[model samples]
Target: MTKKGKKGPSVTAKAEDRHWHGKRVKARAAKNASRTGSKTLGPRKPGSSRAGAAQGRAAERSSGATRRPDAPELVHGRNPVLEALREGVPGTTLYYMADSDERVREAIKIAADRGIPLLECGKPELDRLTDRAVHQGLALQVKPYRYAHPDDLLQGTAPLIVALDGVTDARNLGAIVRSASAFGASGILLPERRSAGVNAGAWKTSAGTLANMPVARCTNLTRQLKAYQDAGCFVAGLDAHGGSSIANIPAADGPFVLVVGSEGKGLSRLVTDHCDLLAHIPMFGHAESLNAGVAAGIALYELARQRHT
Candidate 1:
């Protein structure tokens, strides 16, 4: 698909999932969503300004019906609420069960320090805010997420970057971001359309990574990759089938952009064509692939290991 007058990664959906991303420097390609039934917000190139805007629009349109314009929408579970309160992201209300356990109260103590109000409510109240939401006796009502820009990550010297394409699972997206930050990646990118944007679940998945990691969203993935190229960095994609082993390539550890595709489908064709290198992790047995998060963790470690070595 074309995004903002630029061509984006293309895919045909073969029996086996293929990857869709090009290699480049710091800038990143946005994400692309498949058109099974949902709306198409548009593909995001690597360096496009519209990436984050597109993501905001998609969240509005996709969840517009369920969310209220003004009210206390809930973020369930202790961790999600705890992180938001600690980070000072902003909140409307804090809800906890009247009989909330010890851990929940401790989390509330942290929120209280920030002057965030804590409401002690009944099971019915928690039930309404969450239908089997797994509140764990704690939930928070907070404002929507705020995304950063690619240039924000590039401010530091030899900054590391990560670009995600078509990662639909919020949990995976969150875990990946948490891993990125844990390993000291400077920036993270997601497409405006199909990829997972920051939400409560994603936020929780990060285990507070959103608070620390500088994540960027874009309208077009290819354009963003091009922008990274102009900045004097290398870009690469993780593919199960590719030209070089992940351990053999040097770019995996350099100041570059690392692109990962959807959980099932690897890289899209359009993004693949634009890549400077396609690297695969060497498999020893019948195993052909790995989880998106696992792949990211291992790949990122390889890069880190290379830089240190």
Candidate 2:
């Protein structure tokens, strides 16, 4: 008989070996899939790359969901929107919910005449855009105001600059801009923070003067005042208890920067220290203080008179 060195493995054993190998392969694949799923569902720690990516996505969504800070401002209400359009406030678009009202029709006409894009949106959309303010079926998207450098106002001989210290009222700022333009002021200076910016309210209150006036924003008011001083401009702070009257200031005849304070508080301590002189508006009436807008108007008139004389 032929010699057989060893008995070959049984067919049953061979089949069992294949079955075990297949089960092992399937188990490994399922384990890998579970691990990947866990990673997808896992909570990320703060400051981790994954967390940062999630935060970035959230920020993007938020920016898209609401109006951006630098976006064009919306002037709501039929009269306000119409007036803004009439005053030629730079506008990109005119949005209206209804055109039945006369004011709305007029505004639509004005916008069309000015070649501003007209967008007909629903009431809910208008409310969302205007922050639920009284839109009255009309809204005008005004262009953002462009600011000038603080040094840019140094042009012209004996340039007069009005610097606001802590004025936070937009309407007050608008009024001041009106007065500054009227008195031939070179420009208006404002602190970047804790101050009112050129907004719709300011545009309305300015009565078109904002278009002509140049407003400069500075990061540090005190340092900007020093820079102006170094440039041969006298820095004067308007104070109720100032040592000298605004009319008698010799600096008014030369390059000057008149700093106006807030209505509630006069000049800040740092600004007061940096001032070359503190000048007050003479008040014979019993009124102890004036609002920033009125005070600025009076002070500017005095300074203008001094310069002209």
Candidate 3:
């Protein structure tokens, strides 16, 4: 007889190997699940094949992985899109569906006049572009805002700067920018994180003031404050509980940076520590605190008055 071919592993040995491999896979999956807090682990059962995918999607959404912070903003709705175009909010593209309302037609005309490219798409495409927001067959893709440098705001002999700390609301940011422009602020300073950037809401709320206002973003608000201080600018933070009123700050006459915090939390501890002084807006009413935008406006008006006087 011919030499017997090398026998393959018996069925019993093959089954044992498969059992150990499955156990190792399950062990590794369990370890990963424990670390990630994910309930779906290991190879999913045939009956629940979609469960793992569903869980992964949920995780991504919860972590904000789907948000594109750098993407060009899409201003939706006929009225809003038309207003943005009218306000000269720089835009790259105008997307719309046919048979739109008068507002949409007006937006298209403005976009054409401004030389912004127009893309006529279907309702489904509009819906996708606007993330299913109420687009009303209109959407304008706004150009990404260009932020100024913190040093750029240090222009003029006595430059006035408005810095926001933890002011997350885009509307509040817009309102602050409006006030800053009115009060002769050199520019607006925002921390790179935990602060609102100039977006569609801010553009609407600013009433087009953003077109003129130069906004800057910094990596560290505290370090920026120190730098401002070194540059002979007084850094005053707005706080509900402070030693002195904002109007009474002695450094109001010189170059100043007015740091405004969120309406609810006031200022963060780190920011407060870094400030040269903490000032409160004096109020006679029983109200606890003013809105961040309102408070910033009041403080800025006071500072402007000081400078003129």
Candidate 4:
């Protein structure tokens, strides 16, 4: 059985062995990576659901509708989160730092009492979640907001309703919502395109007033204005050089629709034509105009005062 200078095995066999070993190593590494990647969002600690709820969450993550159009989705900052929780805003999850402050602790307690899922994350994670907007180590995941149809709003006996033409700022929309709520307007009418919806920024700016207020999305602002006019609503559009002053309008005492346009462009030609009258807030000073939010607030306050008087 002894052979002189015989190699243990053929070079081809050694090469095949090394190739097989490399493949095995790669398979092991891939399996490890898969396990690690499963926990990319972080570890599943206590209070983190892992049953059907987890599966449903996974499904939501996989589906395109995880963040619905109407939902609030993300709300940051302590006041915003605290106010949202206090206002009973539907929260899906509450992301907070493990080492947080008193305000954050209060928010955490409220979220826990409300049965919201609490996920502990770091500051960097919070920053990433909120697009680096000073989250203050807290973020709330809210449910989608339910938007009302244009026709649905007409059914109510709202004395005054505000329709936005092209005010695209979310803060403006939020401020308008607050003003509308304060002045006892029925709801807000927003165009589906080229206008802002009730997003997180709007919700935060609204100070949780959006929870009580209903917003409707209109397909065509001009058509909606015309419908309001046809339904006996005095549709008045706001313009800098409007023919009549807001205080001089007698129709404002009755059920009317206040149409506010964008800050820069004012009302469009079609929307302007649909208005029963153009009402301007007279200013003796040199200031030409006010922002959409300010103008709407002043208009609403005026209308409310007239109605109360």
True-structure lDDT of candidate 1: 0.65
Residue lDDT tens for model 2, 100-218: 88999999999999999999999998888876767788878878788877877877757899999877777788889989989999889999998878887677677667877888888
Top candidate by lDDT: 2
Stretches of model 2 off by over 4 angstroms after superposition: 1-72, 97-103, 122-125
Q: In terms of lDDT, which candidate is stronger, 2 or 4? A: 2
What are the models' TM-scores? 0.74, 0.70, 0.70, 0.74
Residue 63 of model 2 has an lDDT of 25
Model 3 residue runs over 4 Å out of place are 1-72, 97-105, 122-124
Worst-scoring 10-residue span by lDDT in model 1: 33-42
Instruction: Report per-prediction Cα RMSD to one decimal.
Output: 11.3, 30.7, 23.0, 29.1
Lowest-lDDT window of 10 residues in candidate 4?
34-43
**Candidate 4 to truth, TM:** 0.74
Per-candidate local distance difference test:
0.65, 0.72, 0.71, 0.70
